[model samples]
Target: MSDPKLQEKIIDALKTVQDPDLHKDIVSLGFVKNLNMEGGNVKFDVELTTPACPVKEQLRTECETKVKAIDGVVQVEVNMTAVVRSTEHAQPILTGVKNIIAVASGKGGVGKSTVSTNLAIALSLTGARVGLMDADIYGPSIPQMMGIPISSPKVGSENKFFPHEKYGLKVVSAAFLTKQGQPLMLRGPMLGGIIQQFLQNVEWGELDYLIIDLPPGTGDVQLTLTQKAPISGAVVVTTPQEISLIDADKGVKMFQ
Candidate 1:
């Protein structure tokens, strides 16, 4: 016979489990799809908001532990599946920009943004029209690194802000929207939305290359850009350190 008491305990324990990115309890967030208990063997399904979730393993482990702590549960099994958010399927708003290239690094502090900014400038200076998109929503250092003051884009009658021009390269970033020295607290879905707006809504006005400075790690932003946009290719940057190389491999596989 099934143990209703044990199942109740399992559900109560799951209340403490939260999605790392959304910062909401998994049960309330509706991630727990279904729970089945057959002869002390428990199985459950977890639906994630993004396919590139970095904490999938962590979540699985947490679920297992919570269920196992129940009195009658002998073993636990979890099946995780990613369901793309509704907004992610919406049509892109920048069709003018071309040749999107994601510049990524296995780890931070590898000068990936430096390479991206200089490359955009160099491409523009060489007479090929260029645009640089600082997609690093968490730590947007492009505006400062490129010496552009943190300022908002001028809203036009059409409700689109013209991109800021620097070194002949059109630039856009979340830093431009935020007040100076303010924190950008954004979740994965929000970050993906911002990137989409930067690409589709911004009036880049014809370009040979649109270089995207992706945040370090293999996460939602990287996955969204490549899947949403017609990404031509990606460039992986890393130091001589072996640890960096391991992360670099993960980054490359994210594209493949």
Candidate 2:
């Protein structure tokens, strides 16, 4: 005879499990799908928001542990799958890119680019395909920090510029085209045009994460990128200061 009471116990256990990102129990969020219990073996599948989720393994382990603690449950099985969601403004050029994360700051000299560079390196170290785009046209520094040979992007078919590769990262920076310490001298419209080319013309194939180091402050480049690119999210870097906090608030509001 089947024990209906045991099924309730299994579900109750799952209710206690929460996703770190969503901060809600997986069961209530409808992540625990197609659950079935046969004898003492409980089997189910977990559909994550994205395959690039950093804590996917942790969630799976928690689910297994919670369900296996049930008195009558002997074996627990979980199948993992990912469904990547897209923004309404997603562009075709970024079709293969799984996630576009922009690192910005309220003002300059706040180490925004440094944070973006190191974050990309850290993600690459984890065996993920990572790319870094220095969106700071007037003061692009990723080329120097990454030690990439100063060279122009090579043109691929369909007028796409191939991204420069270094340290297992695909990188694109305006510094590659202009000499060190040279000024861009471009107006706002021109700056927006350049940023668009970087997004639409760069051949960044199938990256797990594209880390964009946006120029500090809420400016033309930031506004252009936000409007033209399907940015999955933003990271605002700010030091402990009153002025920086105020500027950081503007950055946050721009996204909202």
Candidate 3:
């Protein structure tokens, strides 16, 4: 037989569970729903903001831990569900993407592209659907580092391009579109247009993380991406030198 007072203790326990992404407790966020208990058995559902949430497992574990800590709890079941929340400026081209993270650096020598490529690959290794876009039109190096042969993207319906794959990471880069050793000789407007096409015309389907490697320093390409795309966050890579820190500050401010 279940004591009515145990339900109060269970509810109190759930209040301690937090959803890191939402920055709120699961109970306060209304995630602790359909809670039913009989004897020492308890079950409930934790609805998340997205199916591809990076921290979904963490939240689930915390919820179970909190409930199982209740004095009368013998069995705990946590059901998970997702209802993806859309941004106000969400575009049709990025419908399937759950999150976008831009990797930038203060200067060219910094390992921004290397970090971007490996981050995408690491995420993919974790069973996440990941995509990497080389926004460094003038010095795209992801294809070379990933050892993907230079080739153009295939066109699909509505003229969208399908991204290339290497090591389970989906990739799109200006290097693939340009001839070897050819410089991207163009003005700011032309460069912006090309960046737009790279983002909007690529058929990136159902990705957990879309990592964009921006060109070194904050310039026309960076401006175009920040203004035109729905960037969720930015990762500024910098060296220990004061100069690098100074420029990295600028990159951070640009995103802010």
What digit string (tens of lDDT, one per residue) describes model 3 on residues 54-127?
88788888878878887878999998876545454545558788788999997888899989988888877766
Global lDDT of each candidate: 0.82, 0.87, 0.85
Error of 2 at 243 (Å): 2.8
lDDT of 2 by residue, 1-256 (tens): 4578998898899899888788999888888888888899989999876666788889899989998999999999998876655444536658878788999988999989889999999878766788999999888889989998787789999998899999999999988777666777888888898988988889998887899999988889998988888888899999899999999988888888
Residue 183 alpha-carbon offset, candidate 2, angstroms = 4.6
Better of 2 and 3 by lDDT: 2
Candidate 1 Cα outliers beyond 4 Å, as residue runs: 1-93
Better of 1 and 3 by TM-score: 3
How well does candidate 3 match the true structure in TM-score terms? 0.80
Query: Which 10 consecutive residues of model 1 have the lowest summed lDDT?
Result: 84-93
Q: What tens-digit string does per-residue lDDT give for candidate 1 at 90-127?
A: 33534555467789988998889999998787766645
* Model 2 CA deviation exceeding 4 Å by range: 1-16, 20-47, 51-58, 70-83, 90-93, 125-128, 179-183
Clashing pairs in 1: 93-200, 94-199, 94-200
